[model samples]
Target: MGAVESRLAELGIQIPEVVPPVAAYVPAVIDGDHVYTAGQLPMVSGALPATGKVGDGHGLVPPADAKEYARISALNALAAAKSVLGSLDRVTRIVKVVGFVASDPSFTGQPGVINGASEVLGEIFGDAGVHARSAVGVSVLPLDAPVEVELILAFV
Candidate 1:
């Protein structure tokens, strides 16, 4: 296995197959020395684990669960990046991460939720995972997924 894959295995993290695009875009594309991934949802075996806006109140997905979803979405993004590069070892650094949270109007914890993704990347890649990021709260997301993540990676 590649060093990145070995690292993921050591952490007991299995990168799933890249989530198929719901629309017209490809899962990832290579540009110069970087690979950019499309937004990824927390899909498992072709289905979303949960759905709804995130908040602490009734009828909303909890921020903690949403955080886990963001982590899964990041894994999906990594799968796409590896698919494009043919191996995760090609990735030298994570460049940027952009996460969107489908949120209840009162929820303002987008950064904490996106930390799920960031933390996982840190566990897998150490300092190479540190990157610029943005976490946004939105009214809704496609498929009502609670969180979505995308990534940019610099590769050899």
Candidate 2:
């Protein structure tokens, strides 16, 4: 296995199949040396694991759960990148990450939620996973998913 794949195995993670797009766009596209992925939802077995705005309230998806969803979304984004690049080992750096959180009005923990994605990438890629990032709070997301993530990767 490639270095990146080995790391994933060490972390007990198996890169999942690229998520099929919900709309017209492709999952990922290559332009020059970078691979850009469509925003990915936290899908398991082709279904969202949870759906709701994230907040502290009882009816909202808790911040912790949303964080886990962010991780799953990041994995989906990685799958998209791999589909285009044919291997994650070609990734020289994680260039950028943009995370969207479906959030309640009172929620201000978007950054923490996105950390789930960042942390996992770091574990897999070490220093190469560090990147510029944006954590946005949106009132809603496609499929009402609690979190969504997209990635930009620089590859050989």
Q: Indicate which candidate wins on TM-score.
A: 2
TM-score of 2: 0.99
Q: How does residue 49 of candidate 2 score in lDDT? A: 88
- Score residue 105 of candidate 2 by CA lDDT: 97
* lDDT tens digits by residue: candidate 1, 67-138: 999999999999999899999999999999999999999999999999999999999999999999999999
Write candidate 2's Cα lDDT for 54-147 as tens digits.
9999899999999999999999999999999999999999999999999999999999999999998899899999999999999999999999
Error of 1 at 40 (Å): 0.3
In the order shown, what is each candidate's alpha-carbon RMSD? 0.7, 0.5
| Candidate 2 overall lDDT versus native | 0.95
Off by over 4 Å in 2: none
lDDT of 1 at 49: 95
Worst 10 residues of 2 by lDDT: 14-23
Runs with alpha carbons beyond 4 Å of true place in candidate 1: none
